[model samples]
Target: MHRIFEFDDIIYAVLQHVKSSGTDLVNVAMTCSRLADSALNILWAEQSSLAPLIMCLPQDTWEVTENELGHIVHFSRDPTPIEWERLRKNASRVRRLVGPHGFTDVLKLPRGESFIPDLDVSGYVLQRLFAWSRPATLFPNLCELHFDAVFSLLECSSKYWLLRKFISLGLQALRFDVIDIPTHEAEQLLATLPAEAHGLRQLTVSADDGTMALTVPPSLGKLPKLIGLAIFGIDVCLTRQTIANIQQAWCLQSLKLKLCGTSCDAGGIPLELPSLKTLHLSDGSLPQCTHFLRQVTTPKLSHIDIRYRGSASPAEMTAFIESLSTSCQTGGYLERVHVIDESKIPDPLLIIPLSSEIFRPLFKFNRLSSVKFVGVGNFNLDDGFLYDVPDAWPSIRELKLTSWKRRAIDSVTFTAMMSLASRCRSLQTLHLTVDATQSTIIPRAPDGTEKLWPTQTALRNLHLGYSQVSEVARIPYFLAEVFPTLFDFKWYDYYCGHYDDPDIAMISALSALNDALQELWALRKSAGDHDLDERWEKDSDDSWT
Candidate 1:
């Protein structure tokens, strides 16, 4: 035997690597006594389903049947003391029961946007098992669980209360899905979890997209130990109280709250969250964004994502931008910001009056590295405003300016873009719509014979969204001159909401432009001149010369 394998840590890590593959792990375990001892614990530590664990009991005690609902298991009678002893030994090694496999691995769930597990037998089975598991849970050492079975806790029903037994003090992470659980019971169970699962650091309770909207449980503001909270398909009941509680949860750092309507109050005392770093809000109306942001402040806020379902009016847009400056502190430490409008606001693209005035407030955030706006109205921004962007955000890494409608006229000139690469030397990605119908190339050398591109930076990816480009033959050279380091370039397609495709001819032209960009980069790499932006042009000698 190798002397290095004698160390316990080395043996454990080697076994851990092959744990994901059952066949390899089994082979390693059979090879020696030391390997087998460590493999047993890893095998029982995480389970994708309880089917295998339930089979640990005596065969005569339980039965499995296949009906329309795929698979169901039932116990003929309670397990004897000997049977319980054997199960308890195996359960001690169980640390995680909520494996990657969903209920689809156990049952034939309905087809929908999501699968909400309907555990008619799981609840009953857990009750009988715990009746014998006194002074501790069945899986006493369990540290994580995804309790998918939703059960209604009726007034007279004592059976449903056993579901709470899974929330042990040692558990640190949990993903609880509520489908048919009564609103009052769900709220009570969530609020009381701190008593049983005081060590819990993460919790997520959500329903399917079209399922019943779960209410925000009371006393969320009191969870001092909870590190993250996310709730989806929520009705936002007690909106004022919920926000107030969240404001006081100083330990909370991340939040994802999707509201059903414009339920925020017009006026309230500003809520202060001293520890919050990331916020994702999905509002029903764009105005609600202003309403919500008007009252809360995240001092340590670094990343914010806002998604609204309706069209953004100029008034609402202006108010929303103003709230950003107030919501974050004077440090201007925000790093990533994304505002997306999921509205299918149709046609007349240029009718809405939008310009640099609405988004000017964001430029004050000196630490911003990434910014994205999609489905918002098109910007009639002139090159003068965009030219100031490089100086405003010297550390900027990514910028995606998108819209849902095709541009009638591109106001942003292509002439001013090279300055971004020159000034913001760290800039890497750029997504913008510009008028590339004319070239901005100037004399490169002391004599008037050669043309030079802009300053080279770390810029690698460029996506021209909804830009007007008539001079297709001139664009590749124009882009290569400015962004000599660029490797991936796309046209018209971007992520926000969606955009009406340009005419067929325009789509073909843009696609051809992308193909040409890739080919150019490949050619540059083949010639081993990827770093030198000084050498480039359309020379017919099949060489960079």
Candidate 2:
């Protein structure tokens, strides 16, 4: 006789493989008592809407009528109370809850209007469901809760009560989408966070409507376990006292501010955030950023990303960069710096001066790895800046110099590239526009002996802008000598699109050189005593280029 798997085990295995819905799981549960226990757990793990579960109540407790639009469930006239014990058994298994739909627009239906008639009925059923489940804590196992279209529900006292009951469950993360809610009401909703929410690790509050402005409750700083906080499309002014509260908390590690306001008074208190590691500022005005940077000090910040609309004045830009540099030097080394300019300029060649003083403090920190200067125009660094680049940031893995003028590429450009290949061995991605013609002449020794290009074993991606066919022809040998690990090469030309197509002659030459290098490597591996020079001299006449 063959052994048989248990019924519950079979059901669990089937559930894992299939995208079984709640109704399908209910049917399986009715088939066997053992399956019922396991099926119910999987049925309520993730709930997009509570209608299906609510409809499971007895007909006398709640009646659902099917109409032309969809099924609408409402409280029955008969005084048949909800079976709280039975509902709690399944509700307790829910680990995540997505807020119901159509709470804001009455005409909008729930889940495509298939079952819910209007917002009024949806809100009525949801409120009663919460009221019944409140006795036993509806979602005892809930860890993540997302609230969408919460503005309309917050207007009703009973619905607000239901909202509070759910938030007091000590959830790990909470997200609120407050669109079109009055500022005061939004504040009230935020103030309802229970003291048990100290375990909350992530909190996000965003408003979709531009006219809506929600304030950040000072009580938020009291969440001891909170590590990530994101507030967008809301006006949150960080005053001296508020900064003090944030500093005292000392648990936050990541903060994202978008479309927010910051005010730094003349004698404002210094905002010291010692534990913050990542800060992102977007859509913030230049003056606002300057004030915030001047007041705030982050000792452990590792990443700073900024995106703004208009251009910053020279004085404002200088102050902001200096403040950021000072903070990085004191706190920890910066790993990445990204500045995106959103202003539109008519000229293609706009030079943004990145003076030595702006980058001097950065040289002291070795952890600086990825640097991107993106704008409509190019960025101009001082002369000989590239000479110290390898020494200043030896750990750099990504370097991008965009929209540079033709003058940016001169005789010194080749020397700079050689230096980067020799010194910054960790570089993996390099993006720059080079005049390949300037690199045709190979470097030679004082005695007129040709020197070999330094090998950059880590380089894998290279993007070179417009180059002549002749200029590109001379690069395959140099690339084979310098970048042994390079696999992705991109070059643009006025006539030949990209040099990546197989139909292109340049690509064929590159491939041949790559094969030759591979063959040479294989030969060295097979025979340790093989003279590489003799093999190369013999094949020099038949070289790929």
Q: Report the number of clashing residue pairs per model.
A: 1, 1
Tens-digit lDDT track for model 1 on 223-315? 658888887765544456567766656698888877664364446687887888888888557777667677788888899899887777788
The C-alpha stretches of model 2 lying farther than 4 A from their native spots are 1-90, 98-128, 149-162, 194-196, 212-215, 233-242, 261-269, 313-316, 342-357, 404-415, 440-449, 465-473, 491-545
Kindly list the per-residue Cα lDDT of model 2 for residues 1-545, writing each as its tens digit.
12333655766787664334445666767876766778778767766555556555675666666655345556774224546456667678877665553122212223553535432235566655665557227777888777553223334445334555667645888887656455677677766553757678888887745566455677877787888877776454644444565565578898776655444445364577878888877776656655656667887888888776565545566777777776565623578876666554524444445454555556666778887655423334543666788888888997765543333322235445655665788998776544444445566788999887567799866655332223433555566567766655554322323355533544543354455445535644454535644644544221100
* CA-only RMSD, every prediction: 7.4, 10.1
| Cα error, candidate 1, residue 41 (Å) | 3.9
Per-residue lDDT of 534 in model 1: 40
Candidate 2 clash pair list = 299-331
TM-scores of the models, in the given order?
A: 0.79, 0.67
lDDT of each: 0.68, 0.60
Q: What ranges in model 1 sit over 4 Å off?
A: 1-3, 55-84, 99-136, 149-160, 207-218, 233-237, 344-353, 442-457, 481-485, 493-515, 518-522, 525-545
Query: By summed lDDT, which 10 consecutive residues of candidate 1 come out lowest?
Result: 536-545
